[model samples]
Target chain A: MIKKIFSLIIIAGLLTVFIPIILNFSFQTDLPDVAKSYVEKGSKDLGAMNIVTAIIVTFRGLDTLGEVAVLFIAATGIAVLFRKNAINDKRPKQISKRDSSEILLTGIRLLAPVILIFGIYIFLNGHLSPGGGFQGGAVIATVVLLLFLSDSSYKINHKIFGFIESFSGVSYVIIGFLGLVLMGADNFLDNRILPLGEFGTILSAGAIPIIYTLVGLKVGTELASVLDNMKGDIE
Target chain B: MTDVFIIVLGLVMIVFAILALYLKDLVASVIAAGVLSLFASILYLIMQAPDVAMTEAAIGAGLLTMIFLLAIKKTKQIEDPND
Candidate 1:
């Protein structure tokens, strides 16, 4: 009872401290100068219909690259921590575990392809829509998770995932270098390597789609590997 | 209308967050946390940030919840009152 009351008191105190700030907050009526310029020229400058994508993929491209590297490091750390458990297990590859229900297996089989397609579509059309590489990659990882849940014996091939992840990471860096070599130091990760075609078209965002696609593939494989590492025996 | 929805969602999220903090069952706490994330994503959508909403829903609600559940499976499922 005392704990509950104390929690309530803390909550009330927080609300008291926060309410004034919330009430005083006013929406911005006009875009700031940098934002105004981006809103005005982002589509033309990057050929991306979605201004947010343009900013994330090109205007702050280096940041996105850094974010991908961070994710890779995290996944690698998990894999390394779990590697001993994976190597020590000498159980037969075909150990018979209890099978999942027929309904679940059937449902996953039916929905997996569609979900895969949707994930692909999200990253592919990221330049024109609100979705992007990270979101789409997460969605793809969800499919892998569903498959794992439906089949106790199902195992993702780490070799394939590793190849895809490394390839995408190297290609992403190569593309960034391409921008630097072709343009200038200031244009690293610039999407203007290819001509910015028609506005609002799927292929019009120059290399934004390609970059996002690489990011999606890398993120998807990294997340899947993390999930796989976590699925090892706890003993 | 959107303001009202956001306000309601915010309140509900707070309730879920408190529930998550206080729940004795670890699974229930994790689920409450996930529900809070789900409501937060909806609030983001109502505020016209679909990209952030997608991320909050996918990573925060979906993957984070699943990871928590998996971690709980590897450990204790209930909180010890004395601890």
Candidate 2:
């Protein structure tokens, strides 16, 4: 009771500190100078329908690359930690996973394909939509999670995942370097290496779709591997 | 109208956050946290940030919840008072 009351008092104190700030917060009515420029010229310069995608993929592309690298490191860390446990426990223990309900199994069977297609669509049309590689990759990872839940014996091929991850990461960096080689230092990760097709179409947006596709694949594989690690050793 | 919706969502999120903090059942706490993420995503949508909303919903609500559940499965289902 004392703990609960103390927590409540803390919450009340936080509210007291924050409520005035919230009340006084005024929403920005106009874009700042940098934002104004991006909003005005982003679509024309980057050939992406979604300005947010244009900014993330081209205007600040290097940051996104760093973000992907961070995710890779995190996934690698999980794999390393779990690998240590697997090596330490040489005894094979009996693993028991409860059988999923019929409803869940049937639902997953029907929904998996649709979810897969949706994830692909999200990344493929990232340059034109609100979702990009990270979101789509996460959606794809959820499918892996679903499969794990539904089938206890299901195993992911680590070799294939590793290949996909390395291939995508390498290709992404190569494409970024291609922009530098073709244009200049200022054009690193520039999408203009390929022709920027019609503005709002799927084939448009120059290399944005390709970059996002690679990002999506790398992110999906990394997340799946993390999930696989957490699933523990089945054998 | 949008302000009202945002305010309601914020209140609900706070309620869930507190519930998550206080819940004894680990699964219930995880679910509460997930619900907070779901509400946050909705708030993001209302604020005209669809990209952030999608990422938050997929990652915060879905994957994080699943990870927490998996961790719980590997451990205990209830919060121990002493430990």
- List, for all models, the DockQ compared with the true complex: 0.65, 0.73
True contacts kept of each: 0.52, 0.96
Q: What pairs collide in candidate 2?
A: none
In model 1, which runs have C-alpha deviations exceeding 4 angstroms?
A1-24, A85-96
lDDT of 1 by residue, B1-83 (tens): 87787778788888999999999999999999999999888888878999999999998999889888878876789999997
Model 1 lDDT on a 0 to 1 scale: 0.89
List residue ranges in candidate 2 displaced over 4 A: A1-24, A84-88, A96-107
TM-scores across all candidates? 0.90, 0.91
Model 1 CA lDDT for position A168: 97
TM-score of 2: 0.91
Provide C-alpha RMSD values for all models, in order: 3.2, 2.8
Candidate 1 backbone collisions, by pair: none
